[model samples]
Target: MLYLTINETNALLRTAHTDAFHLEVSDDHSAVADETEPMRRVLAGLPPFEPDAYPDSWREWDELVGEVTAHGVTMRRVRVVSEPLTDYVRFLQGLTDRNVRLGEDIRWLPRHLVDQADYTTDEWWLIDNARVAFTIFGTDGDFVGAALTEDPAIVDRCTGIRDALWRKATPHADYAPGG
Candidate 1:
């Protein structure tokens, strides 16, 4: 496994284009907790992040999606979640609308309905069906790091899984978010 820090991972993604940015989100990693919620900002009557650099995910993500989609790359994401949703998953659902508006096609699949769809214990990103960055998460579903690989067979397998799951997963609009 090739280890890469989160920044290294983002740096690589920034250079990506001409490929589909497909993510298989298998767990709720509480990543959204790190970002300041819009409602909180409204409650505090505060302004948006200034400069909106790396740590400012709201702006960084907006820029990233704008850049990637402008290059004709399709970004699709699928989440496999269990019933009796965790607080993190609920938070994620609240955040999906922003991602959808940013041009990502998001979907959700409940655990009972997973059936035979392929899934990794952790999350992964399939870029262009050519390369993959398998993100490692801790036992508590915290962000760990990622491994980058380009083996054709590995890419092919992940591509097959992504295609299959995406076809069956519920689109963001149709899926109900559990509490």
Candidate 2:
């Protein structure tokens, strides 16, 4: 099992060829440093974070998504969230349009509709159907590191999970976080 720093994972993402699918099971990644200020702003009822005001890493990510999508890579994310929405999930919901605008497909899956035993608990990014990068979060839900695996079994399982959940998830434009 090889581990990758966040930067390393980003680099790998930049190298993607066909598709990049992300599965997020956590309701809160608020402890992530880049998210703190935005989460606070959201909680305070401020308008969504402006693109120009995004954290440096986030801005870079947005750029990367735009670049990759322009080159024909399909990027998709499915977030499995519990409702009534957590503050952090609400925050993400507010910001999802920007991701969609950048050409990434984002979806939401209500937790109640999913059977826990049928899926992996960890959040992961499966790239080009070949590599899987599992995100590791601290106990407090802070971003830690990632484990990258190319083992066929792990990649296959993640692919299956992503496909099944994606079919059942609601597209960003159709998802109503508060409802």
Best by lDDT: 2
Report how far off residue 48 is in candidate 1 (Å).
11
Off by over 4 Å in 1: 24-27, 31-55, 138-144, 177-179
| lDDT (tens digit, per residue) of candidate 2 on 55-159 | 778778888998889889999999999999998898898888879999899999999888665577889999999999999887876676799999999998989
* TM-score for each model: 0.77, 0.91
Per-residue lDDT of 133-176 in model 1, one digit per residue for the tens? 98866675556568989999889888888877887789999997
CA shift at 164, candidate 1, in angstroms? 1.1
**lDDT of each candidate versus the true structure:** 0.70, 0.87
In terms of TM-score, which candidate is strongest? 2
